[model samples]
Target: MISDAPFASPDSEPTIRVQDKTLLGFRRSIDNIDAALIHILAERFRITKAVGEYKARTDLPPADPKREEEQITRLRQLAAESDLDPEFGEKFLRFVIDEVIRHHETARQSE
Candidate 1:
């Protein structure tokens, strides 16, 4: 079975166990970014939850392919402009969109 963790392994070592000051500083920054990402995702989900409910109430489809495509295109352009990989941006957005669709499906089922 696949783990739900953002970073998961059957066996892994944490840098803290080695006690390298440089690595420790880098990890601290990474940890802060990870926490921020989680908070941003939480807020995104909260809004998506409200959107899912509205869609269900209005008898709209769970997945909006047109809008999804538009977002992908927009984000890809933004990613390129920001010197980030457009492909990675597309993949990330697709993952989030998939999760949102899953939530929308569950909301529909519950309603």
Candidate 2:
């Protein structure tokens, strides 16, 4: 009988053992991807922070609706091409944009 546990027991079938290894491999890949995503997000925030400082120095507005709209559209198209959900892409971009705008506003206030 097949066990419902995540990992194969010592007496489990060879196929189940192989499946366990395969599952581990997939999880490792996912972990690596998650790590890369975090690094990329960190880099993006760093650049956005610099942009906020620059905008504050130059007396520019914190939020650019036109640019945000363009980004949303572009991201949606990219998501569709990548077989991802456009709405999810837009939501992610909006969340990041909102955080960036908040940072910019704080920078402006300090200027």
Candidate 3:
């Protein structure tokens, strides 16, 4: 019953697509965030890998309490500067730092 020309064609109701479009938007937004988080994790892993290599090459112990303390201090400063939850950020950094040290240990043992 509609004409072929643009002016006479049946116009679609936008709200009819709202639910599907919102779901797709949510999925895409989450995918973008997940990709960014993966990138950050990859960078962290690369740095940890480098540390592992260094420790392996130099026969250095990975657990340096003094160094870790220094790192904690630096991280706390960064959290404060960035207006993040300092305690939580420091704890998370410490956990990841310990994980890096464990990786270094594993690398050492594999050699």
lDDT (CA) per prediction = 0.89, 0.91, 0.82
lDDT of 3 by residue, 1-111 (tens): 322333432585333333465767898999999999889989989988988888888899978899889988998899999999889988898888889888989999986
- Candidate 2 per-residue lDDT, tens place, 1-111, comes to 444466656795633433466777998999999999999999999999999999999999999999999999999999999999999999999999999999999999999
Better of 2 and 3 by lDDT: 2
TM-scores for candidates 1 onward, in order: 0.80, 0.82, 0.66
Which portions of model 3 show Cα errors greater than 4 Å?
A: 1-31
In terms of lDDT, model 1 sits at 0.89
Candidate 2 residue 21 Cα shift, in angstroms, is: 1.5
Q: Can you rank all candidates by lDDT, best first?
A: 2, 1, 3
**Model number with the top TM-score:** 2
Residue-level error in angstroms, candidate 3, position 27: 7.5
